[model samples]
Target: MNEKEIQTEIESRVQKKLSDLFTTYKTDTDSLQAILKWKPVVLMIGNYSSGKSTFINELLGQDLQRTGQAPTDDSFTIITSDGSGEGLIPGSTLVSDEKLPFTYFKDFGEQFISHFRLKKVDVPFLENMAIIDSPGMLDTVTEKDRGYDYMRVLGEFAKLADLVVLMFDPHKAGTIKETYTAIRDTLPESSGEDRIVFVMSRIDECDSVSDLVRSFGTLCWNLSQMTGRKDIPRIFLTFSEAMAANPESYSEWKEERNQLKQKIQSAPEFRINHILQDIDRQVNEIKLIAEAMNAVARKGRAKLGNTAKFGFAVSLFVFFFLGVILKGMTGFPEQTFLAALLGGTVQMHHFFVPACGVAGTLLVTSLLFTKWTFPRLRQKARNSLGNLITLETDYRKNLWSKVENRVNELLKNMRISEIWFEHQTNLGKIVKFLNKDLQEFYERIRKIK
Candidate 1:
């Protein structure tokens, strides 16, 4: 399908899956409304001191986000499109300290904390596309508890991203592995519609133009090897500091900056298309799995239902059989024994009493057996049902885990060329092979049901 069509399909699938899950909890209405009004989200992530904040300022064409000569030990500074920045603390808000001016390195640590309560910011950018300015990874001060908390939050938010911009400093070029690990460790295999783009930030720090180009090339190669996505786009070198320092000095840099802006502007739609197709595939997989699991559960429930009916029928049959046996043995009617039993044997004349004795014995035996034996039967049936439910749950979980692992491996092994070709190629043989594989997967799952 074309990009727009694919994107529409993906959005539809995502909406449907979200709708179904939320509907189970009766919360689909609000979620659906939110989806309808959803905007593109771009997440800015990189190691600390990678000029991420500086880049944000450049992007906004103002010193909106804090940038300084040294690294600031702040948590995430989420700048939304609305031109508002706020600190995000774990479970509280500092309403009294809203719109605090960006701080420099000298203003880091508890000094800043004392001035502001970290509350999430809702700004104009949130209306169309939200930009998350995450704390740098691998900061020198590792002991800070808040940094770890910030890392955790960033990881959780990674799933919400449409694109991830990995900003790298040329001076510390060797830490790309650490950078990739920081991101990969936190994100799930199924994070939707996200693309990782490397940015060789602070390019002006390079010795010369040639040095900058070489550095960018090396960065691209290293990232390609590390990510196993050789077809992934090359790194985009940026000099946010230079751009901020003298917006007019480098016309070429300015042109490049504009190009990057255009790329980002178009990336949301580009990614949405791929994400939509992926989501459709994922939804189909999930539906098949769910159906199989439900089938197993239904079978177990049906067996339990039958067992319950059988137990009831057997109990009644036993009671009736006891009545027959008592009538045959005592030469007295079952009703006489019941009446005597109800009347309490206080006036028993010997001959009549003996006549009711057999019925009483048989009735008492049946009652005792039914009371004692049926509990074990019921317990067994319940245990069987419980075991089936547990089995089905475990099976589904394992299957999902396997799928996740396989997909992750596939992504990790994917060559840059393959990803590019995936978009470019229409080789009939490869298409046929993929179709066959998909069919095989469906058949295997059907067998599982």
Candidate 2:
């Protein structure tokens, strides 16, 4: 199917099946839909002077971004085509545009917005895609230094992009603190494993093939440590041909550059599948949350049931002997209600006082449970949230890790009991969407030529 047709089909399926699920579970569909509506995005991230912009310029066949050995650009510049001419849009304006998927960036504050922009070019290569060029990652740089969290901003962009190219140079070999943090923490949360391509750019600068091999080995070891994945992802070794005077000398790896460029161009092809996977992952996250809530609800019900049982026993005792206890304590109304009952001297007028006493006892018991007992139980459940869900499998554990904070936030700020009962039903809907409707969508996408 064509791009528009595929996009429409995905949208139709989500609206018909998963839209309500997203809203009920508090997932943001606006950002998801906004990402769907825009052109496919290719996010470029790497160390300072890692040839990210240089490679982008090569792909666009023009000098669109400044090139330098040091960190050249500090702004997040989005380069795309309008087919008219060159133009620029500021970050403040870009975030306000509902048509784009960048509204979340406004939360990063004015300092970050001042460093964000969009550049429109007339290049044919960008007619169907947009390239986001980020400020290079640096070592030992704190969030206070940037006035915003760099890895966080990267993660947000990574979440929206169809393809993320993490470029590196032979000089650094992925040892930078920020780079380590991104691989270790951010990408796993934002982008899927398949969406990121590891590229070791500027390989030609190595003194020898052996030197290059050592750098590659170092990078592999570091990646293993950072990602904790035994299998190392494919890393493209490339260099800018424009900067290579001895092009013939580096002919062996020149085709790798072309292949990387081709991969970037093919980002649009990745768009549909990426969207499907993103939606699936998000829906599953909501499902995981619902499961935890169901656990909390179960705990809560058990606690309340125990309390009710105890309270019922107390109420029965009060109903039978309250008058006797009162008479014993104050020596008033000499005959107990039980004494009247056994002696067969009870009248309808005599029953009123004891009946009222039993009713008042029950009311006080209910009030104590509601006001004092249940809140403490809820707080205890919140404290031991890890015990709520059975994360026996690795996948369940990982999913729990992702939504744990969100669940904690909800439990802390909201009355979870009020909303907890619907979770079981929500779980059913989410499961049906994932196992049935979403699988059908996957099949339909696969059938597309």
Candidate 3:
């Protein structure tokens, strides 16, 4: 089949699998639907004068973003293709428009809302993906004075972004404090490390190839300290034509720059894998909740079983104590079945007395177990959910933390007595999505070139 047909089939099967989960488990998937509404986004971030805007202008062959050396732009701009060509939208309109995904940016307040905008230019490459050019990362400590958390906002964008381009230059050498904090604390929090692409822009400004090497080494050192990874990640050495060239060694990195651009062009395909991962993570959350409930249920059942046994034993003991009291007080036989042994005579006609006593004990024990003991055990289990977090395995513990609050909400709105679901029922559905639907979709994508 053609690539388009294969992609359509894969998407159809994915949606069907999601629908099946929604039907069986009653999960909320409005968040996932919201994600699919927007185009795959390539987010560009860097310090001031880092040639970010210049590089984007080269990629689309249009000066879509305003570029200057001294922090010329303070707003976050979204550049997308428009068939009509050259349309500028203000932040207020950008968020308020029902078709856009920036509605959540309203929480950043009117100040940030004023700083966000959308630029539409006629470009065919933008048909598959959109680009976000953010205000340059500054190392200043006056963010509270600015009335917004800059890194926090960037972190949110990183979470939704398909490919995040972190542009640096030889001048900064990765010592941008704000950039370090974003990489150290913010980006990792979003769990989008695999989507990050590091680029050292304006290497032409380094004067010589040896100077460029020194700057690159400094960047590697700083990145190692911040990310705490022993292995060094690949960083593209790139310079836009707007900067002066190192005439001798300029051609050395001629291919790396083109490869970086190629990576940007390939973002839409990367978005497919990201979407699948998001769905998988969501479904796995449901599985975690189901698994936790199942574990709690197993423990609850064991408690009920013990309660049943003990209750019956206590009832029999009480009956025996009552017979001893009668025998001591009025010479009534303790063992009605063996009354003749205790006395000197046998009464075969009095079989009803012993039979009735045993039958009554069993009936009372059964009633107490169902009406009092079992319900109380369920209540106790529900109350101690935090303690019941089956962290026996690493995967369960990690997944449990991700879905902990959701599980609490589920158990809160649901009946604890019924939280224990049939394991294979919900689990089998998850397994089907993972092993069958997802695998088939991936195979189809693989076959499509």
TM-score of 2: 0.87
Each model's total of backbone clashes? 9, 0, 0
The residue-by-residue lDDT of candidate 3 on 345-410, one tens digit each, is 656544444555667777776677666766675566567766765577544565566567766665
| TM-scores for candidates 1 onward, in order | 0.49, 0.87, 0.76
Top model by lDDT, which number?
A: 2
lDDT of 1 by residue, 268-349 (tens): 5534432432333343334433333343334434544555565556555543454445567996553543444556752444
Best by TM-score: 2
Record all residue pairs in model 1 with backbone atoms less than 3 Å apart, i.e. clashing.
10-276, 48-136, 48-137, 81-125, 82-124, 82-125, 230-416, 231-416, 231-417
lDDT of every predicted structure (CA atoms): 0.49, 0.79, 0.70
In model 1, the runs with Cα more than 4 Å from the true position are: 1-38, 81-127, 139-144, 147-149, 182-194, 241-251, 266-271, 274-449
Which ten contiguous residues of candidate 1 have the minimum total lDDT? 97-106
Query: In model 2, which residue pairs have backbone atoms overlapping below 3 Å?
Result: none
lDDT score, residue 273, model 3? 58
Shift of residue 122 alpha carbon in model 3, Å: 2.0
